[model samples]
Target chain A: MRSVRYTPPLWRQWNLVWNFAQRDLKSKFKGSALGWAWSLIVPLATLGIYTVVFSFIFRAEPPDLGNGRDGVFVLFLFAGLTAWTFLASSINGGISGLIGTGALLKKIYFPPYAPVLGAVVAVGVQSLIELGLFLSVLLVLGNVGWSWLLVPVWAAVFTTFTVSLAVIFAVLNVTMRDLAHLVTIALQLLFYATPIIYPLTLVPEHWHSVPLRVLIEWTPFSQFIQVFRGLTYGLDAGSWMSWLTMVAWAALALGIAALVVRRRGGDLGEEL
Target chain B: MSEPAIRVEDLSKVFRLHTERRSSLKEIVVRGRSRRAGSFQALEGVSFEVPRGTTVGLIGHNGSGKSTLLKILAGVYRPTSGGVVVDGRVSALLELGAGFHGELTGRENIYLNGSILGMSRREIESSIQEIIAFAGIGEFIDSPVKVYSSGMYVRLGFAIAVTLDPEILIVDEIIAVGDEEFQRKCFDHLFRLRNQGTTIVLVTHSMGLAAELCDTAVWLDHGHVRAIGPAPEVISEYLGAVNENEALSNDEPGMIRAGLDAVRSGSGEVQVRAVEALDQLGRPLPVVLTNEPLTLRVHFDVKVPVRDVTIGIGFIHENGTGIGGSNTREHGVPIQLEPGVGYIDYTTDRLDLMPANWRMSTAVRSHGHVYDMLEKAFPLPVRSSGGSTEGGAVRIHGRWGAAVQEDSPSTAPSAATP
Candidate 1:
């Protein structure tokens, strides 16, 4: 006998995913006076604090814009913070997506990935707004280039990477309640490790026996930040090595996420 | 013939009862795989088939696996063993507004909930007007659903679900919402859908509703299939078992006569031997028809001689509300009792009860000295003899009339006043 399972094609289910995303976007800023401004205000505030501590207090120098123009420390910091904030928020939001909808899951059956993907898209929209404002600022500064056209490419890559990790963590968080806290702490440490606040040159070439600079350069988050910075702020194409690392990381994470969701997604109703 | 809409083969579901609710990484690491307290078999080897274009009811008490079985069919819960094949699109209203976001407006929730039920944007847009009209919450459609009254919330949820025109619909006790008028509207819509050949699976505690709406019924007890057949037969058997269980649990002389199908509680001095609804010809009536003459015959055994005895019989609606009752004392009639078996007959020319299931409660008392009381002593399945559109518990035979009189100058009151 044929089994009673209805799994519509992923493309057909896009409307459901969009609906979930719309819910996330609207409810996120539902009752605030500032509304969508808070999305920008939050990262901007973080930018302000880091600019004070690192650029002014610690006297850190930023890299040049590569277009015969001097680099402003705040603009340099905002470019990297844009990428970092999107990754952090999307992953964090994705982790709670399944748990928050546990009540709905217990009563109805839909694709479990819809809510998590919706959350990622919601954060992606906020990140897009931040990117638009940052690009406009760069345009005003006359830092535009052909490399700037590659921003969307890097964005698609960045989103894939972010969604993969989000799906993974979100599914894990359903069974392990403490995983969210652990992820929060890990993201905090990752923020400082990615050189978003300080320049990449601040890291020492070597620390005793370890190649500290090379290790940080090869990290997925560091490479993603470098590629985003190159396409927009630097006006230069990222190196092939960085592009390869980003793709490889995204592909690996996507594979694992697909496997995890397939194995555990069907039984989530009982778990919730 | 076409294939059955739903077919279940030896379905079962077992839930692991977590002793400590250990759902954390730390607890799992410390306690390992042996942390399972025990396993509860929620359903076991239950099987049934519902033909296409027919409605089936799952009837059982709480924790009898009815909800679990419905959830399994709805795809919310998977069976631990066996398989079920359901044809066509399925929409499950397991809980009204289950997908609604509190902060989203009613209009927005329609799109969200509709899509969750597998409706396209065009489908939702096309039926949106009908859904809003059915819900009857006009201006509130634009307001956030959190501000809606609970009745409005349920109405909107039900409206969206039914308007989608799903080929197979699964509902669990959601029709018991809203006021009487709204409930009537919902039933009208459901009947319309059923007429259009939509396969429906309903889980309800209302045996009256089950008898009215379902063509077949599956009675489950403690995760096992007790009976499955025509709706009324299965329902009667289920109710009989329920009353029998109630009779067993209560501590009274009722326990001595344990096989009685009704709940008996009182002193053993006098026992109710049997209670039957009879027709005018003195034959046992299987079911009482509304607006027809009927008689209730109560057989009693007077083991000890008693005086000034009053025998009473009351009719109660299936929903547990007492309709109307009368007794010998109220009618100024006293029975002279002795040690012997006797019977009493309560007859009426017309039974004014509406078309629904009613229960009879019989008792024998004397000056507050209770002899015996039988709760839900007899099942009075009152059915309509024809297509009657009347509503409410009792059918009132009233008439409406209109008359017009010719204008007359001499007979006018104004001429007399002048």
Candidate 2:
């Protein structure tokens, strides 16, 4: 009999993870006539609608680029939306990961996190592609800067952070199905609460003596968007405090995710 | 020598049956605390060891925990309170195509499924050709599996599982699917694996298959181990208990009426009581040896006087294919019946049947009108003295001879004259 380990190390299961991720990516556009072009088209369409609503309708002022040129409001919104879309889709996919692959889990023995991580990686790849297209648009607009080198570094950190959150929510969603619904509502609220659509300058320093600016600045989504806009839109590496905050958030979420998985993952097969 | 391949100690699994299944927060809040639902133990203190290089079969009725035990062994389910130590790598075929995606092509699925089974990418790449050849689905390997027939799906699943060459293989009634030829191929592959000393654990309803393949059999009944011993002995004990339960059920008034109306239909004159296979010395034989004289005796209770009665018997293969049959009228034998109980014997000089499981079907008719008919009323197990190399339902008896022939019409007469 083959010995089974309930939680195999991620490095050992890399191939399996890659296979799952590939399957997910392929099936996303499998039979469609547009194929992978749809990956680009869907986000472009979303960016177009958001730009029209916030830039033209709301008359939001655009931030200045590091090249000392007037930043296009569409470019400013695209930078923030890229990071926001990655976070939203990764968490959503993670929430459904275990429930969707319940049939496979009941038949075979592998680490429960493989599918969850695979889903995160699949979305991560799409987000990277979207980032690439956004950078190309910056290149065409002559808004490039040296700080853009840190974009890959920030993306890696953001992915690790996303993975940790995905794992925690995936494991939790297995026991309480209402978690998914709650998460969907929470994400919709968080989108507006963060600086994805509106400029951070619009809000006062304090609302009812609450110090609302500091509160919004520390929200993980806001911190991520701040660093993303600094790299591609503002063309600066942002502040060390923001970088430290991103790393700390990733580390904290990872610790909680590990604890959640260790406690609840063993009996997942029975629950399924 | 070395330790057994698998050692399961006092394994138990209890499933909590949630009556209301309050997975929503609204229900939890409205109902206060989530009430503890009733729990049913699927497997209780089940202990067994499968020796290295030997096969063990789990046999039981549905919901008897055979499947639960297999899953626990496969590591798909963890035992509640017991420890299961497996010595080597394990591959379980709990369900064919368990991880298959409908949108993926057959080749893509193999890569994904193989990796899920713990094969490295290189290992799957190395054996991809062999798996495709074994499935025999031709160019359909490139087509998405959703479009393939169910047989093709099962074939590909079985192919990938068997080719993995794990130290211990776990299977659950997977061979029951597919055509006969494919089933034979699967058996041949399993036989080879057993010969190569791969420890195997199988769950199957076919006692004949269990007897043929397993070294030992474990019989489970209602979360308890009823018997564990040599394959044949344990199977016979299980079958005996099943027959007893059936007889007990038949005694119920409702079941008796239903049985008379469904399984038995005839005129209200003669009613068949029982069917038995007996040895030449007139003793009830549960298993008959090949080429031995045997008799099928049919007992009947005559409710009214009858004449020109014909008692017939038919041998049906376990697959429901009819082997052959005969009636007293076909042999020019006539019988007169009156009230009271009696039995008619259909005796044969030699039973020329290969080693396989068969069923006996009997009927009584008079004046071309049915009297009592019982289809597949009794099981007949034929065992060869030793393993036979032949296939199919019946054994053919003939002599092998050779004759040298010359290239001349007159001289080749001996070769042509059989």
Candidate 3:
């Protein structure tokens, strides 16, 4: 089939994404009494447990570390968790969407990425709702402003990055079923490696030096959280260099994913 | 536009089957050492066009390229080399509920399935009430579809497709999804869609349905175009092929005699051929069924071993599921002497079944094994007409039961338990 002369309009694609997200949200809490309210209650309960453990049981005190950055500890946790959850939830479904829907692939063909795109958007929409609750907590304590813009910017970068990663996983998962298991391990490692519980400054000075700091700060994953942190504290996200890095990553990874899917999409249905 | 709805020129598909498939890691390691695998040519140089607002039937054997052609048109599989240009929007109900997400609720899935089939949300929103109403699954519409009975789910899905009303609709098979009533509803809905100027492409196993519904038919065999045009003509040829195959494998000596019992072949019923008994050594024996060693010894003159002679048999329970049988050529035994003369034999060493309608048939196989049949014996009735009938077909060897009271009320002179 020849690619149509008209480039695929975003609105049509976005509509598909919307329908999938609607189902994703409704399907998640479909049978329950509260339904989607579980999204709010589960996280709130997790926060209660964390507050009791760190603030009460341990009798820990907020560090007299720095300025506004030091006070936004809960925000840091939520910010990191928000981006991390998006990645985590997405990898689970996105990588396996094609594998899971082998029945449809054998019969009806659409863009191969349709399932992954829908699933990512579905999980992303759910995470945004969770993000809103965390943002409300921040508002109750103080004020939230420019950080919101950073959230969107980071979201754009993170989505592109995660989507690319998801595409690669999708393509690879069909041939190498091991990719799904490997992605799970990778998500686990990223959890502790990133500064979710503590500030980026909490790492000792020697540990954060030169290349080590550069590695952490320059990572696409780091940008996912860094931009959000920068927004919350009303700080700048480095210079044009970070934007250049993000754009380059999104372009390269996406290009690679498209190439893999296109070259191999023909035989994929048979294997699936 | 009055253009034909579907068009094809030299449409063909070739599928490659590797001798052995290797994992990605194995491929990387053995790179240049691996050899090319065997391939299969499923379809080649086949082409047909259905005029706008027409229904076309596709009939073929199980492995026929009918499905392959449909999939390419559905855009699921691209042809290895060839082209298919459809002039209007195409919707494939290749399988009922083919695209439904199990986790999604009935209401949410309606919107999803509707859009996937090309309905705008606004269109779906307007039809949503009608669709739910037609589906007849009241409050359960809000429940996840995972819990829906297959019949209910397919009904809802078919409702969405019919309501969408695309310019072209392709259905792989008729409504095998639901009960008879539901299937009739699907047919009625499809008939309505057909009248509304929507071109339909149908692939089905039922000749009656195809002949009644489709204006034209395309007969495919291992990807080759066997016949094209008029549904009745194409279906007739398809059935002819099926009858030929059945003839090659089904025959028996004196089998004609089996078709004629006094009860069935009475009066105007066809004449019964030689009936006798036999052994494994082509010798004679007697009394069959439930551990009696028995056989048939052929005897008689075939006024003519008519060009279309089919001798077949079947063991059936009252509820009707056929047990096995074999024939003359099937047993690798020959029919004797020539057209006007015949004497041969066969046997049933252990007739493992009990009493039931055991039907032995004789017919003229009209054609090869690709179609429904012509039965000369008219499904012969084999059950004992009277007292000899005692047990079920399974031969359970167990006693029957009855719950009768020993009240002796008459002896007590009209008694009521008060």
* lDDT top scorer: 1
Q: Which of candidates 1 and 2 reaches a greater TM-score?
A: 2
Q: Per-residue alpha-carbon lDDT of model 3 for A1-272, expressed as tens digits?
A: 23111124556766666676665667678669998788778766766676666556764444321235455445556666777778878878777666766777776565667677877888887788988777676676565565366567667877888887787788778876767887788888877667655556655545545555556666777765666655654344545776777778887888887888778766665667
Query: What local lDDT score does residue B264 receive in model 2, on the 0 to 100 scale?
Result: 74
TM-score of model 2 (CA atoms): 0.85
Error of 3 at B199 (Å): 1.7
Stretch of 10 with least lDDT, candidate 1 chain A? A1-10
RMSD per prediction, one decimal? 8.6, 6.0, 15.7
Task: Give the per-residue lDDT digits (tens) of candidate 1, residues A1-272.
Answer: 35556888788988898888899989888889999889889878888998898888998899998576877889889999999988998888888877888999888888688899889888888888889999999888898899987888888888889999999999878878889998999999988888788777889988997988888778899999988898888888988888988999999999999998898888788887
Q: DockQ of candidates 1 onward, in order?
A: 0.63, 0.62, 0.24
Candidate 2 lDDT by residue in tens digits, B1-418: 8899999899899988888787766677788656667888999999998899999999999999999888888888878888788888888878888888888999999998999988999999999999999889999999999999999998998888877988888888765577888788888888899999999999988766788899999999998999998988888778767655644654321111112333776775888777666778887665566777877777889988999999888888888899999988989988999899998887877988766777777788988799888887666666654434466799777998888567777866655566
Among incorrect, acceptable, medium and high, the docking class of model 2 is medium
Error of 1 at B130 (Å): 2.1
Cα-based lDDT at residue A235, candidate 1: 85
Can you tell me the CAPRI class of model 1?
Answer: medium
Task: Rank candidates, DockQ, best first.
Answer: 1, 2, 3
TM-scores of all models?
0.81, 0.85, 0.72
Model 3, residue A193: C-alpha shift (Å): 3.3
